[model samples]
Target chain A: MKYKDFNHWELAEDAYFVNWVLRPNKHADKFWKQFLADHPEKSEDVLLAREIVTNIRYSDKPRLNDTEYNDLFERIISTKRSKRPSNVFYVREAQYRWVRYVAAVTLVLASAILYNQYWLSSHPSDEKTIQTLVKESPRGSKLTAVLSDGSKVKLNAGSKITYPKEFSDTLRLIYLTGEAFFEVESDPARPFRVKSDKVNAEVLGTSFNVRAYPDDRKISVAVAEGKVKVTNADQSTVRFEHTLLPFQESEINVQSNQVVKRELQDDMIFAWTNWKLVFKEEPLSLILKKLERWYGVEFELKGAIKTSETYSGSFDNDPLKVVLEVLTSQDAFDYEIQGRKILITSKY
Target chain B: MKVFSESSITSNGELKKTTSSRKLSHQEIVQGLEQGDESVLGYIYHRYVQDMFGFGSQFTRDRELVKDSIHEVFASLIARRQSLEKIRSIKSYLFAAVYHRIIYDIKKNTTFKNKNQKNNYREFNIEFSVQNRLIMEESNREKLNKIKSAIKNIGARQRQAILHYYYDGFVHEEIAMIMGLKNAHSVTKLISRGLKAIRESIAVVVVLFMTDLG
Candidate 1:
């Protein structure tokens, strides 16, 4: 028999032997017991292997007492999230109260929309008709808002999201500009649709980021959790449609109407939502561009703009001055900040 | 109408351990779940919350996040009950669900960066060892240490593969699906290499122990 040539470790690794040890049957039990009895010399190896299979265990698990388990079940069964004035970004709210929510929403959104009158003039939506609320995060500052539907949005600096105060029975739609990370509450019946400048993302339930900064050439949608279906805007006669799973993202070019899908390189894409600045092997020009939105400063580059050199570091929302110091130290450039203007002159 | 197999339900598979014959099988629980019976969610949650918490904590240390992910997994499973007919093993399906959920949570929900943050993301962490009683006995101390040291020498991925296979009662394809490998072929290679490492590490001890036994 093949068992004659097997060592203890091989016997332990063997599936047939492991099955006998883990899930014993009468037939295999009799066969293995007789094998051990007949081959006394191989008994040691067989016993040793059996021990190995039986002994492997992970660390002890976290167990709830009887009370906690019962409470957890009760909590999970109910419509758990009751949206009662949750703080921004830390929103675990349940859905309730349409008029009161719209009141609070109008306070933040009315001023925000009016403040960007020039930007809104292009679309010129007659506010009396549809009744949509818009929130815009000013340059150099992020804003978090919990929608009436209990979905959460973390708007990046210089970004805006126009959403209805109360979603219709059939659909929940929102419009976006610049970039925003959304933690959409899953409601399969009413699909959450985020219509950006030139791209639209439709998701039943998901957490994803949509970047459609007007200045940027490409509109990108990156999924942190769940799935997102991204497509080109109606302006494009040739429709673009693609579904992105977790840790996957899509980029749609404005001019070309091109759609590309790729794996998310790192969680750094989510750093902004967490209030972190994590740069992983990023080019110098791109770094400066992010710094502009982060600090509300414009870079006036003189002598040479070093686009080739790359930088990598993580900062916990460091001040602009300190960040500039660290950045200039790595490259031969001197940056001077004067009234929200950053002047950088490359030495090399 | 297929009854649950022993191997599939081996991970605390029975609802209650009574020979009186009222014990609910895994298949029945799933069937009830598919039939819009919300009560099974309670059984499933109470039955597997501890295991789910334990498995999820391996990926991310946040206790609340793990609990929340567990709730979401069960909640979402109920939300899509119509798709339950195809699931073979509820344990593996729940585990895979929790695994994916916690991982996705880790990607976005991680607010602070501790030193372990670099090492903690997107990895199935596990520890391997011989049984406690065997390690403590006087006669087997040296031999068991040798065996454990060899097991420790296995890589993290290999250790996870082994844990899924032996402890969790997952076949190669299931392990492959859980670990996000391409197929069972890769999982087979990973297990073989891991066993080979342990074998070479403990060959001398096995021989020495065999001689002592003789």
Candidate 2:
């Protein structure tokens, strides 16, 4: 049927016309282009109908925020892990069910221990050591410290480093929560170890960054020079250990006990040292997490962001609004800032 | 419904690209999922979970149940990723899968005490608003209100059909799959009928307004 005679309202009501207006594929575009050419007088009707279809905003649906989405995604991914082919040792269907139950119990216990350790480490009691010096970088700032051993430590925002004023001849140990870049002096006689809640990185004389924010489920160590050994320090009997040379990084998932080691590009591992935040095709959720840590702001996402969606850009000391505006420019989302909180939602 | 045109100009004047660019297509995502790629799975979750939650919530007001159903759907998709055939419309397939899972869960949890409660579940209702200031002029206020009421008065199934077609950008066949209709033709008919109802209502309102003016 010829669409030329249809009024603007009729065209708007037509499913095909509405589809063309909202999302014109190649075929739809071709057809509409030809139709406009054939009946130039109907262009206004078509445009008006298109405007109506495009502007009609539907009621907002209840959506899971970024935190909720990430939480649910973690659950889904972990559940998948439990059913992996490698776990086929529990081949019998009934036995598989039993193993899952046992695994669930073990997970609960493991996480509880991890949480306890994180709490204790973050709030180390005053009675523990009189000689220890604690340096803290409040939100929106970085702190640098020189240990007695001549090692340099650059603490990220909202991070704290606790170490002894004088290093023992046996070992040089420091505790960190949040993120830090360390340039340890080469002392083969005494290996240096940086401990976080979930993992420990030991080195003889190497520079590396350790990110183990208490709220983050994963701990990452990116080595910049020399060799560093990373080991999962959770109280679980089965431990994970990995060694990283220069230009290597390892991430340990605290909950699933998964370790991922990969080669690191210079920009990927060390950009934050230069006061720049670089994300090489990272998910919006992970990017949000990093932004929260760096800027010490709360981010609340209001709509569904596709799992396949990723963003890649670098920001150097940009305001939170500028960074957000740049990120949301390509995606059909909008962001608003209220004090220290940013709310992001899909734009209608 | 509209196909995802990847070339639309974004707010910042940059060309929009799909989350799944050349490096990550639907097939690759499915393959990654089968290979237990955590990031890929996470990407899929970010993409569809909210819409799935919204659709599932339509069947039941139990928010917990809806969340559970969505979780189960993703878990199952991951488990079966290796066996799944190439998916044509990932969005539609996901919508259908989540819809069926929610219905199954609701049926399994049905009880005599809650049997009547099922009737209390609200039908799908779409709130239409005109945001264009030009259209919001005083002259168009009556017409806008009429359109809004007309939308509100449409049948539940019709409203759902329109929502899936327009807002969700699902094709007629996909809408049919999500709604469990017989075929795509049925979806087309449902939408046309719904629009016709709205048109008739608006016509009546316009006639009454004109008569009052005369």
Candidate 3:
């Protein structure tokens, strides 16, 4: 019979007959007896159908035994595990993880060759300290860029730094635009200076952080080890100076050239280096900027609402959509996304 | 027909060429594999390697081609073991892997220069009758052989669905996945259609083979 002669319900009946009735279920027995009573002349066709059903059901097909199946799976998994990288490839932890891996590996390899070249030419390994000079993170980004000097720099969002290919014999100089963390190689002979738009921080063989985003009015420098000189560089002469000790930060107001000192919490300032974004009553507009930078996307809003809303929340490095979705899940907020733009409105 | 003792009816294990390895119980093997044990892998290889090799060999008469393809599946399992999720049922996965490897091998070899390579590949299948001839005799043997020859004349996909469902013993879900159908229901329809086609082919083969005697 043609397939079209049967409807979907009939097809279902055919399935029910083939699978259930032959096996002798209560329903199947009732259906089979009723089927015969209803159409006695077609009993042979039904019996043939039953036989076909049983044949289809009971046919001995080949398959892998348990022991063999397990062994195959085990071997495949073990090999894959062996190939996994040891370090958590946290893309946002240091820089974009995979890119940073390739970039770091390439940079290390390239630098290693260059270091070897330098060593062969100079014939001294210990004389020169190699460091990676990294630029500061942008306004809403936390990133690490290797400096040419082998001094590692971790840039917080809304930060930038510029350093020389090689530090001069007399001085190590770097220009900064925003926030950054620096691990400087010990060289008391050559003092290292980071020049921001308003604040200048000088250090020798120490780790410290500087925040001097151009858009922000404050230039803050926090010292973790040793000491640093925070000075107002915009003045014709050094108008203000603060000698900052460990666990101390100096904030310089760019507009007024005024300076303030505050005792530091190491975890709070260094948190960005560890892939955390901390906020204390931060403006909603500022948080949006950070989200956009973190996810490498752009956000647009109506001008009037951008400056009016303020938010307080902390986040780790996560996908922008995931972060936004989580944020929207909170009470008193409703938001919708159209393509890349997130339209935020308060629920209350 | 060839005669064989009980000893010759060995479990599905490796063969040199020209024969298929026997099918084994798939359920237990799959359960063992999901438990993170390597022993199961070896057992599966031993059990299915011959049958998989036999099925693979039908695509090409060359013994090395079948062996190489079978070996590749094992090697791939080893290399990608970590990535593979612990499977609850391995029958679908194993057959799918073997079938894919066969297709890959066919594509890689430049010698099989032909138009509609996919159609050619689909047309090549290890049918039931030819396979049963080695183990059966008399009227039963004739039925099996006639069925196999009849299967060759059917449309490629229909033949595949029929042979897989009837001979290889794949379920609708497995067959659908292998044939790239959207769901099991589609597979059921396809299979019923295929069986009807096979039945027609069986009628034609019976009439043709029987008429020759007259």
DockQ of each: 0.14, 0.15, 0.02
Of the true interface contacts, each candidate retains a share of 0.32, 0.31, 0.02
TM-score rank order: 1, 2, 3
TM-score of each: 0.50, 0.49, 0.36
Candidate 1 vs candidate 2, TM-score winner: 1
lDDT digits (tens) for residues B44-146 of candidate 2: 7657777888877776776556766777677667666325665677778888888877777676567878765654354466765544432343466777777
Q: Which of the two, 1 or 2, has more lDDT? A: 2
Where is the poorest 10-residue window by lDDT in model 3 chain B?
B1-10
Per residue, candidate 2 scores C-alpha lDDT tens digits across A157-261 of: 777777777776667777777677775655666777777655667766545566656666666676654467777665652377777755567766666777788
Candidate 1 regions exceeding 4 Å error are A1-129, B1-68, B71-214
- Can you tell me which runs of candidate 3 are displaced by over 4 Å? A1-143, A157-159, A236-238, A302-311, A346-348, B1-214
- Estimate, for each residue in A1-348, the C-alpha lDDT of model 1 and write its tens digit: 889888877888787888888889998899898888878899878877887777566644556543334434643654233333433422322221111110000001111122233224323453344457889997899998988877778788888887767776667777777778776665667887776545567776555566656666556667654456776655542377777755677766555656677887655676666566667777777778888888888989899676767777766676888788777765677988879998999787
B-chain TM-score of model 1: 0.70
Q: DockQ for the candidate 3 complex?
A: 0.02
Q: Pick the TM-score winner.
A: 1
> Considering only chain B, what TM-score does candidate 3 achieve?
0.64
User: What's the CA error at residue A57 for candidate 2, in Å?
Assistant: 4.2
Candidate order by decreasing DockQ:
2, 1, 3
Enumerate residue pairs that collide in model 1. A81-A94, A82-A94, A83-A94
